[model samples]
Target: MKRFTLRTGIRWKITIAIAAVGALITLALSLVVHSAARVSMLESARETQLDRVQYISRNAEAGRKPPMGAKLNDPELPQELRDKARSGRRGTYVQEKPRGLPEVWAAVPLGNGQVLSLHSQFRESANMMRDLDRALAIGSLAVVIGGSALGVLIGGQISRRLRQAAAAAGKVALGDPDVRVRDAVGGVVRDETDDLARAVDAMADALQQRLEAERRVTADIAHELRTPVTGLLTAAELLPPGRPTELVRDRAQAMRVLVEDVLEVARLDSASERAELQDVALGEFVARRVSALMPEASVRIVADEIVSTDPRRLERILGNLLANAGRYGKPPVQVDVEGRVVRVRDHGPGFPEALLREGPSRFRTGSTDRAGVGHGLGLTIAEGQARVLGARLTFRNVAGPGGTDREGAAAGAVAVLWLPEHAPTTTGSFPVIGVP
Candidate 1:
């Protein structure tokens, strides 16, 4: 599946969102840490300086300079501060202003009214604050980067599923009625993905059913129109002996037949999902069928079998085969029924290889003779009926008198019709309807 490009996907959107949020949190944390760490360090520095002054105050002589004097020099001061010891009103004040240092001034009073002062340039506190700020910034950045990566990955997953759903939809739109998306989670996902997959499947199935229904309706309408036209033609032929009327009647009859054939195909193509369940007898059924086909035609039936089927539909199937046999056979249609197998052999030349290969497709007349012959749909209807009945109809080219390549330069096809085994317990009664 094709995923969104880097420039388009949710990965970056999520990453940006993560970074923004993480940055805010990290910034606040960094500031707090910087402030706390710097203040604590400064406090410690001040306490150490005060202790030095206290030591000097205890040892200092009333009239002489304190021994702690040298320790107050720039190198030894809290932050390399410059200083000089002098007594102040509260104590001895230490004064200094070392370049580039934070100022610190302090004094300790003596018991004899003298004092010690600790003063220095700007130093300690500023350095501690700077280091703390740097640490917080680094830590916050690391966290933001990690959060962004996670967010982008999550967004990519969501987008990928969505893309698959989109692809499935496209296929459905293009007439791929079987297109369906699998749920990322079992039993219909709890989210949009589940909804999308279900919707796609539902759409494809509904569309397929609708198309099938329309095809069937069209075919049924055509098939139903046939009888009336055929009747009308027969009535017209009886009315007059004129060539004009005869030609008109014949044309009308032919059109009616054509219309009927078209409709029959439509019906077969459009039949419901499955056929009606009913039992039919195949052996006696074949004998009666062959007998009815051509009177005095050499149609023989050796065995009688029975099977479950739609009687009306089954009649249509067998009638088509018998009619074709009578039309093309040289002498008489031969009908052989043994159990579930019904074989009708005719003296007609076998079908060509090409026709056999095409099998029982619609409109395959196998002959180009444009005479009174019906153009290919009867067999198509037969095939469709057989399919609906759960039976098999196969067409093969059989040799004539000389076992030569009848399929290559032969006349017609040898069609075999097979049904399931359904034997009647009694010869006179209709076989039991169907298998339990």
Candidate 2:
């Protein structure tokens, strides 16, 4: 099964969160401001209307002409206000006018059977409220935008630190334990991200130390056993030809192979190991390798491109792969060469999940089906040798439940070795090491 994670970046997530909060706050403030402004403007207009109409009522009571804007029982005045005035109470009403300011009316009883009323459009208060609303809208928009930009700035800093730490961790996983996140980021733990970087750096340091110790131990043990295993093989060969003699020789040979593989693994781990490159016809090379290591395997050449590589190291890698196929996979192993890429496939139950997910691990057969055919160093040795050659090696299940299969072949595991197209500028030579 395959799994995936969301691709959205932390910057976008942070920006969205902050902008949403800012938008909500701005919306709330705008509501409160709009309501407060509307209420205050209406109240002020009502007070002005009431004062003018009352003054006009007093002037008409003395039989003086009212002001121009004031009227005596104007027909256009609201009937509700007129009725209230006739009943000896002051009344006020507001009428909405589309596309313009509101008309405010106030009526007062004159005590002479005539009602006095005054009205005017509240243009100044309306314009003030309109301007206030516009300002609030613009201010809200600005707050949201500014919040988003601030989030981006903050998120970018955090995301960059996290990405660096993650990349360093990935390099460590790929066997480069020297990568230190603290070097890329600051060493000081200023925040959570810095703390993470520090943790990654510490882990890399610890892993590097542990791996170096392990390599030293492995190399020492293998070198110590090499001479004894060689003597044991020689001693077994001198025995009389019998079943017991054959068994002794076979056991000694197995020990020698194991010791040699361990030593080879140690050499591959060293930084001093270098590839001696030369032009090699990939198709012909693969054919020879398959014949020598696994004669039952079939080879197909799609393109006979010449690749510059160390043939000895390439043979070691291919030998391990072929050995693994014969031991753990079913019959009809297939090797295909196309350009600089070589694929080795086997028709058997696909590789275990652990091997597929994490490549090969030392001393781990990865399946109960291994049946003790090897010491579980074949794939690991192959991978290390490939790395020394500056080549890429990948493992996958190309057939069966985990993958698609060839037209008539059963599901199985596939390992691909891809060599660089051209020779490296400098091919440093090291002592030739044989594969077990």
Candidate 3:
């Protein structure tokens, strides 16, 4: 196994720095004490040597200096004492005579100036210095090791909390919006994590509100539209045969038209509708519908327009425009299509100015002639379908083509559908239709 090393964070590193400094200071203090103690012991030993020499001088003859000048650093001493005197003890030192060890002579001084003395023993200063060094080394090492351990423990605690916060943030990024850091261990990240959680919660609440609103609207359309349709079916079943088949047929046809138009509008408003788009050359598509419905109405495909849409739905929208036009416009009803745009302008009295901005509204009549024949749902349904197909249905009162008698007071109604220029789709042409 590898040896463990201490690592620290910002806060703990500062603590460790302080601890290390304290350890160093403690070691320095120990060295100071060791030095002082050694100095004091040497001073005491020196005083003892002087006292011994003075006592010997008073008792016997002596000189101003010792006969040997200084024999404490004698090479013939024990190996341990020899190294200590030169390397450990740097100042004045004294050696004591060992009894019965050779002819060792004790130091004694003459009264005036002559000196006589010889000593052979070990230096105590050497032993004291070694003891001080050993004790200091052990104490200093313990202090440093303990301080470093504490610093690492503090750093580890901070690192763990930071890692937890990062893990929670990562989970949120992976689409687990519900994930969040716990609030129990409050710190710098507390406010920030709380803010993030609240933001996600708010987003979820908004999504649910939007979904509920859509469901409610769908339910409302189903309830309102189904009642009229049921009554119309029953009324049709009770219609007695004969009595001018024309009137009966027209009446039944009128009811059918109203029901179909309302249902188309409802489908457009339904959130579940998805338009199956396809590549369509709009020129041929519009021309076919126009020719089939109004062969003698002088229909014209004015441009080689192209788009992606439900061709059947487009036909229905144009069929509604043509029916409105044929009922109210001049004999030659006109149909024109441009690039991604289908325009049907009639040569009859124009639509009522009041309903121009209302685009597709229920029972909004554009004329009085067709009032009894059908409710004003034709334009509304067409506009709704055009929107669902990713397009806009616009109404405008404009002069007839060439602005001449062909208009024949033919300023009836002009409806234009601007379709989305979708990219080419792989689906087949003329798929099942859906309102926009």
Give candidate 2 regions above 4 Å deviation: 1-6, 67-69, 73-91, 95-102, 187-189, 270-272, 368-370, 398-410, 420-436
- What is the lDDT for 67 in model 1? 60
> What digit string (tens of lDDT, one per residue) describes model 1 on residues 1-436?
9987656666678778889999998888877787787657656666666676666656564455566342322344332122223333222223344655554455554555433556544365676677767777778878998998888877776677777777867765644444576533234325667776787677678877887787767666776777787777878877767888878887897788689677767655544435565566666666676567555545455665557766676778778876776665444556667767766665566543455677655555665431145576767788877766667888775554555553335444567877754422322123568668
| Best prediction by lDDT | 2
Determine the backbone clash count of candidate 1: 25
Please give the RMSD to the true structure for each candidate, in Å: 15.4, 5.7, 20.1
TM-score of 2: 0.84
C-alpha positional error of residue 30 in candidate 2 after TM-score superposition, expressed in Å = 2.1
Candidate 3 regions with alpha-carbon error over 4 angstroms: 1-240, 244-250, 366-373, 399-410, 423-436
Residue 427, candidate 3: how far off, in angstroms? 14
Q: Candidate 3 residues 1-436, lDDT tens each? A: 9999976565577557867796878878997988798667656765665566455445444333333434433445444434433352312244344552122223332434334333433356657777888888888878777777776676666666656656765554433434555542246644454565556556655654675566467556656766775676677667777666557566656655565565566565543355667678888887777889888766566678667787777888889888877875555577777777778876666766556756656666654643444467777778766755757888877665655244234356678888866532332112345789
In order, candidate lDDTs are 0.63, 0.83, 0.61
Q: On residues 1-436, what C-alpha lDDT tens digit does candidate 2 reach at each position?
A: 6798778999999999999999999999999989998888888889988987887777788889998989887899888888898899998899888777789988888888888888888889878888999999999999999999999998888888788878877776766645678776663447887777787778678877888899999999999999999999999989999999999998999899999989888877765577778888889999998998888899999999978888898998999898888888888899999988999998876676778788888888876654355677889989987877767899887555434433323377788998865444454423355789
- Pick the winner on TM-score between candidates 1 and 2: 2
